[model samples]
Target: MNTISVQEADFDVGAEIEALSAGRCDVGAVASFVGLVRADTLAGGGDEVSAMTLEHYPGMTEKSLEAIVAEADGRWRLLGTRVIHRFGRLVPGERIVFVGVASSHRGDAFAACEFIMDYLKTRAPFWKKEDTPAGGRWVDAREADDSAAARWAK
Candidate 1:
């Protein structure tokens, strides 16, 4: 399942992974990645980021994530995959993204997880606005993110 939620609630990473791998005997490995709201950006000039509001094009966002996951499935021996990304206003220490990959071996699981994350960072249509003491600012898309995604090119 590829899910994009815009809620003020918290997500449990352990629960998500368990659900993704449930009852799958063929899955010998599971790799997961969680992204959190950091207090600072790379610019290093903002106040403590007290909260962040994530926005994305609804239908388009899920489609983009599904495509990324599909690419991973095609490239690896994946048994299953789940990606959950949250939008809306979120406080510090809140979970931003969850990526889980299940495969028959450790190598496939690890590679698929990294591939999904790298693709999402650039291809996904999510944007973040951070609340700081200086005020709110929209985080710009990073060039490095594009470069990361490019490594998976055909």
Candidate 2:
């Protein structure tokens, strides 16, 4: 089953993976990625990030994530895919996003997992505001993320 959930609560990675591949003998490989909130700011502020708040446009966010997964499904022979993105207030070490893909082959599963995360970094409609010692600041889109996503365009 393909699942896409956007919630404020944290999720269990093991449970998600188990659910994705349960009773599926054909799934030989499973790849997953989990994104977390960092305690330090990467924006060169030299300040500690205490927490962060994520916001999204509800319906649009889910649609965009589903589209990304569909694109991956079109590209690979995937058995199943699951994407979960968390919003609202969160502290460092908390998970922000999770992407998992199951496939018959390792290569397809790895590539699909990476592809979904790359697109999520650039295409998702989520916004983040970090609470740092310096003050609250909106996280800017990084050129590195754009470049990473662009590589999969080919």
lDDT of 2 by residue, 58-126 (tens): 999999999999999999999999999999999999999999999999999999999999999899899
lDDT of 1 by residue, 50-70 (tens): 889998888898888888887
lDDT of each: 0.83, 0.93
RMSD of 1: 2.1
The lowest-lDDT stretch of 10 consecutive residues in candidate 2 is 39-48
Clashes of each: 0, 0
TM-score of 1: 0.90
Give the C-alpha lDDT of model 1.
0.83
lDDT leader: 2
After superposition, candidate 1 runs with Cα above 4 Å error = 1-8, 41-46
